[model samples]
Target: MTDGLTLRLKYLCGRYWRLLVPVLVLLSAIAFAGAAAGVTSDAQPQQTTVETDSMTVETTLSTEATVTGNTTLYEQNDTLTNLPVYLRSATPEVRLIAVTTTPPDRTVSVTQQIVLRLSATRNGEVFWRDSRVLAADSTNVTNGSTQTTATLDVQQLARERLAEVRAETGNVGTVRVEVETIAVYQTDAYSGRTSAATPVRVTERAYELETPQRDQQTNVTTEQQTAAGGAGGAGPLSVSNGPALRDLGAGLGGFVALGLAALVWLTSRRIGDFDTFRQRYERVRYAEWISRGSVPATGRHARVPVETLVDLVDIAIDSEKRVIYDVSKGVYAVVDENLMYEFRENNDGDMNEFGFVPITEPTESGSTEKTSSDDGAETAAAADSWFDADTEPPDHDSDASPDDGS
Candidate 1:
């Protein structure tokens, strides 16, 4: 098995050895590049995460209504939280609360400011409006939590304000009350390329009131708004060089290619030029005189061996006959009178051409016989001769006619 493999490899190298150097160089370079990439990836570990400073600020608004009168709809007094609707006859009292939150470690100080406004509008025109500062801004440097609160009689305020607008312009307008809260949070976290600004985040919360009157019931609706803010420095990077299997495959492929190149270089033997040159030159120059077939067994004739096709063709031209090339045996021959001239390729580099073979002369009955040197068989008397009608040779070359010998 190993010998067969070596022989095949040698044959391939003989046919394609010119490409070996360039292929080897290419594979070696690729192997080196793969090794470099692996080393680079190992030396510089991927940045999975970066140390970052960050702070988040969130504000929430909450409101509740309490019944301030003894009416048919309640006991002595009832306090309601987050009611879908409130009746004015119940004399509901409303309270608005705002809270701001931040991370504990990132918080330095936080302050909140609250403002409330009451307005009456008709056709997008505000004819009557009132505002009050419910809570002044105050900061607490110790903690991250801050809260602010305000209270008002929403029914009484809306009734009075709407009545004044109706009395002056004789127009019943919708009454709106709004409360806004602002909170500022201080932190040390910052992001960007410039000098870090005092990382300050501001958040707002709004609470609004709405009223709808029926035939016998007047309802008030409350709504709250939420806001958020944040500040942070640079964060981690998410990057990758793809799957490990792909890298391994590429590296191993480069190595395998290099190994193959080395094996071919070490074990291959190129075929020499002598046989190749002879086959090409003879096939082209003497194509017209050569005929491809099996050569018939000789009888009553002597064998005259030659060294090359040129010498064989010279004898064929003199004999006025065509040269017969036996493809299976790789022998070229010509038969004339009593001599069979022959030439064969010497692939083993042996230069000897002449071999002596004893032949018996024809007798009175025109019969001859010859014995093979190795097998001792009388093969020369086995059948009809090449000139006989039953043992005629193959057709001459396509370019030559019947009378165009040689």
Candidate 2:
């Protein structure tokens, strides 16, 4: 029943637009409200760009160069022949720095390696990185300039002559530290004027590297990161406010419509066509007249003989003072309810123009013989003797004059 109701509403919306317009609006409002609520809720949790610090050190270096000066090489620009512009980016400040010893903490270290790693941003583009306020400390900045030095830098096995020169220093247990800082080259050569080194943040261990001990029973606390308007998280969002007033209105409208349809169905049987409609209309009209104590009208007057209805049927008259029988209209054409012609008082009263004689009552059982009387005379006799059996002749008064016989 529910499904059928739904289908009926859909059909009515298609057929009766004037009636369903309000319902459509109500439904639309409900849907819109729900959508709006979802949209508003979706604006809360934003996923921050997550970055993991570099964990391992690498010794290899690129010879060609990676830094690019132009930002427009990303599209369909033919000027960039070496590599796609999107792939070319100027390395940003150190994004990750991690250090570890070959052996984790040790009381006696025979020989170990010091590994340092650094990761940088993909582009020199300045973008906000979500970061927690961990710690702040004072840093020593050296402002020194006007220095010239010529040095050759590479990694290779020490030659015999270089080994002898290093051996003269006689410094045992001392290791030379080499720094690898990312530099943006404005020109092709390693000259001092055209290149500038990007600032790097370096952190080193104060004590020998060791695996830190952890307290196993410690409890972890969580805090909500709230943005403006008390909303949490950051990202695209959706808002929905559930069913609105429009939805309720639509539901109410459907019920009202069904109620009206039910009323129409219950009042009468289905009328299939115009013929059925006409028949039903006539029956209702006739019934209405019967309820009001008037004769039911049948348009076609049946040519009923005056004797067939006897004195029970009402009579109509024409202009000639004679009774009229309309073959097409069964009802009498009497002008007023108080006016009608009486046929006879007897049950089988008069004969009609069609030679329809009323049958008189049979005589007493032994006297079945026919009477020598005209049909009209017998009718008058029956009318007079309805209760009395005999008819009396007129009597003359004794005071009559002698010429009265004349």
TM-score of each: 0.42, 0.17
Candidate 1 lDDT by residue in tens digits, 269-330: 32345244344334435667776544656665688889888888888888788887654345
Q: What ranges in model 2 sit over 4 Å off? A: 1-240, 245-250, 266-406
Compute the lDDT of residue 100 as modeled in candidate 2: 15
Model 2 TM: 0.17
What value does the lDDT take at residue 108 in candidate 2? 14
The parts of candidate 1 lying over 4 Å away from their true place are 1-21, 37-55, 69-78, 83-91, 102-107, 117-132, 141-144, 160-178, 187-253, 264-406
Q: What are the lDDT figures for the candidates, one per model? A: 0.51, 0.27
